[model samples]
Target: MTSTTTTPGGPALELDDIQAGALMPRPNPYAGAFWGLRIDDRHAGRELLRRLIPLLKPASSFDPERPVSLGLSLTFTGLRALGVPQESLATFPAEFQQGMAARAAELGDAGENAPEHWDKPLGSADLHVVVAVLARDTVLMESLITLAGDALRDIPGVVPVWYLDVHVPADGREQFGFKDSISEPAIEGTGILGSNPHEASLKAGEFILGYEDETGAVAPLPQPDVLGRNGTYVAFRKLHQRVAAFRQYLQQSAADRAEQEWLAAKMVGRWPSGAPLAVAPDKDDPELATDPTRNNAFLYGDDPQGLKCPLGSHARRMNARDSRINGDVRLHRMIRRGTNYGPSLPSGVTEDDGADRGLMFAFVGAHLGRQFEFVQREWVNDGSFIGTDEKDPLVGANEEGRFTIPNRPIRRRLKALPSFVVNRGGEYCFAPGLQALRWLAELDT
Candidate 1:
């Protein structure tokens, strides 16, 4: 595919106007996008960027096994953490100039398209530290995810919104295949292709992540004490290892069930080569595999059992399709453009043993907990959907041991669970405003 966008020199084009949500095929350098989260006077964050921007050289190289880049997002929840003088957090934009924003058109339906502000009183967003792909070196991106995770551990209140330690499949699709990222909807004005719902539609201050004053822990919103110039909130998560096992299970499933590899393809909703199940349910649809429009078309008509596709399967459960009971579930869709990490498991390996391999899931939304959290807790993990208490068998967690999706006949054979993925370590972080940067630098490390 060809593109009209060029880095030649001019005001940047709106995000959606760029092809495939990118200026080119891979990541590129964004000069003024890096930001930090910390307490500071009004506009104090700028000083820190002035210092860090020059010290940081344009990246010369990326690691083969693990690359490093910064990804950025913000949260209004951090507004609660501020001194009286700088208490008005919503007015101040983030410190980074090149970063993405949720812009709304001025004409009709502009506010309608914007996330409802029911919970967004001031529209404050507390986030920083975006590890972008300056260039497309999968390894570099991988390292960047880890680097962001590791670095944020020490930053106070910097909650991680959503992250994906992904491996751009050698086949070019995401871990679930189905032509990675074909389903992301284009939201105008934000300069982003997002799946987020309007913040105005949500409850009071319920949209922020890491710290929700109303519902803490499961949904921690920013507090009034941290309101104006609140410390950052980093979203923390660790999708565990199971790459080798999943592949092995698929192969074994094919042999044990007497079905062909195509069956396994349907189970995953994609061909190993990135094709979508919607276009080719019985065979790997190569044409649809590459065409963005053709992917993500399959929806279970009414077979609650998911006979067409396993009810509890990842794709089916993630996007409940039209089956979702209310508008609540509609907000949970994530823009998962993450890649996988770790090696392509040896085809013959029986088990990953203790191999640290799995997806690095990165997603974005105005309020992390309301959308992603709701889906993981209610839909993905609920037994009602798949017939067992499995937290997204692949990405969910159970304190007792590893999580796995039970095989067919879920109604009766409820105990057979398979561990497809695991979770590791994580924390909450915030990508701060430029004024906040100086505060971070000023703080005693």
Candidate 2:
């Protein structure tokens, strides 16, 4: 294998060796499935990768006509199961080695969101390989699923542990009725542009290993060049959204339907149509929401007071975007992609329906600690940066929480905000480069 090196002008990324799902955004109106597998035998696990190589698509070969795609990632335990040398294993980052469950408390996954309460095989070491299949519709999605199933059928020691189907609703709104997947950061060599024009392209190393990052430093690769060069860390989370509870909170806090919508937008920093409150603060502009050029093109410099978009809103806290925060916003940026699972709660309903519905969130980047975990801890679960003790209004663990909306006469504050999103379970895995997959398949040990 050839070693990846940087030049005076930044190295051109090995897109052919990079997984498509790790960089490109999913197609809208997409249907997908997530599968967790346990590697009981090292030989079988290696064989699994051999059969999966042709099915996986590279970042540079995306075709609109062939919309189906597949991605593969392995947990730390999975690498060990495949007989990875102890020396190579020690080179991975601490967060990736410890896994998500071990860092629960630091990530605000306490109370009902603890790891012990997580779904089976999710927080456990039994989970080794993660397979994600996605396509434009169910017909295409099922075709790939069948192909993936065939690869695992005759393998003796590769057992299917868990599975979840995901899709975008007809209205393109998440369970809480908000347009999701609206924002993403641009990478220097990928050619994919950022949603916000005001934002500059981040260095490739920020998201891919073996390249220079925002701080002008290349992140430490896992080991032996070939296995870790084009690889990236992925944080997979299953967040259960309490739609009834979310709706009830807005209904009780507001005076009318219009007021309810306004209050919801304040909490989210965007109208239901995917329009940012920074651009359309007074009302929900459907046209602006649909316009790709202007929907996510605003900044927080003018609204430092949080009048248009609350400083603590989910969107602002996640991105910050020129906001006077304690750190560089670009350094903490990562590619976030999500798909809705389970049925949506019917409109005008404010009662618990006992259906498990939420988002299967995936965070992709090279620096997992600084990019993903930092945002979850400081921005989502804590508010000290914005001079408050409140968590994110929509997704944080908000037991008896309060959100303040800055105004001229007096800031109207909403009290007793409940935790609408619960941490069902999650994992820390490494999506190796295409060459690394072949290396693992031919491992002698």
Candidate 3:
């Protein structure tokens, strides 16, 4: 598709106009809520957007000054239900229309997390829109949801079909005891220090529309340019972690306390403290993990042979750093922000609690097919790039899977690892810019 730079000489990101959740996540949100909306009436949905637009928080508005934030995104069905023209809708990425499950094989979601097992609200016929609310604590977040729900109650067409609450422990670990959301791609325009210093910054258009991307060319946009410019797509997923199973595997695979810790780090490519194996291969470095400036400074170029950090590791597979040979890694970058849900299983407990707990995964990008889906299919679920057929050790479908750890005497392979993470539900939506939202609200339809 032919394209032209929309922002041109202007700044790539107008932080004040973009949704807060699209750029950065609220630090330590005590409680978060996601609302799955289905538009039953067209005009009423637009009316709701008209009123809700005033309450949406912009990315620049996030700071110590304001502790609560709310974000809104709409799916292809949501847009169409609100009376968006067919010609205009045709401009969206093709994969977004097919939905995430259409490419299940590439994504390796065919097992437990397959679409058939997904929550009814996610990727369902009724799922049309999504609203994400963030707050400093559970009480405040609930209050906001109540107020928003009350306001929407009068709007006959739009109603919530599903909801979820998300949180992270004060220690910031996911259910599996890893420091989550630690590695992200730095968008050149935002200056967010997304990846480590060794990694180069990605073009802003890779994550946000209207700007030049890695190809030095602008990405294509929908018609009535005002409605499409500055908007980006989001992939939201509810991942359930099998905490009891993961702990049991670690116990049976390792010989001692130290070996158990080392084995876990090898599976994740980072110590539980968040220190990368490439930086602290032999031991955990709590100090380095906590250091904001140095934690992400190391690279994989020196360890090309996967001697320090295994090529098939979770982190290494997700971000190949200097190891990628076939394509420009910058083009495939995404802005990831997520929150953990469910209480941490008591330490040393290896039995199932059966409580629904896992990660609420959110990926923001301009190209859903190339950026988000490509990573899920190629990097996270397969190992051809790293010269092995192994999948991501921590989240991959572990059907007789084997994890290879390069060692001094000989490489150790952990076998028969079970799938530790399962997909509960998810959706693909469009996070529109302030102007696009205004356009939607004012549309004559």
Which candidate leads the pack in TM-score?
Answer: 2
Q: Which window of 10 residues has the lowest lDDT sum in candidate 2?
A: 1-10
Arrange candidates, best lDDT first: 2, 3, 1
Q: What is the lDDT for 145 in model 1?
A: 44
lDDT of 3: 0.81
For each candidate in turn, the TM-score is: 0.55, 0.98, 0.94
With a 3 Å backbone cut-off (N, CA, C), the pairs that clash in candidate 2 are none
Q: After superposition, how far is residue 397 of candidate 3 from its true place, in Å?
A: 1.8
Identify the superior model by lDDT, candidate 2 or candidate 3: 2
Q: Candidate 2: deviation at residue 192, Å?
A: 1.0
Question: Which residue segments of model 2 deviate by more than 4 Å?
Answer: 1-8
lDDT of each: 0.39, 0.92, 0.81
Going through the candidates in the order shown, the clash numbers are 89, 0, 0
What does candidate 1 score in Cα RMSD to the true structure? Answer: 12.8
Which candidate number would show the highest lDDT if scored against the true structure? Answer: 2
lDDT over C-alpha atoms for residue 99 of model 2: 95
List model 3 lDDT by residue over 346-367, tens digit each: 8889999888888999999998
List ranges where model 1 is wrong by over 4 Å: 1-48, 52-69, 72-134, 138-170, 173-179, 191-236, 256-263, 301-305, 324-327, 385-391, 398-415, 432-445
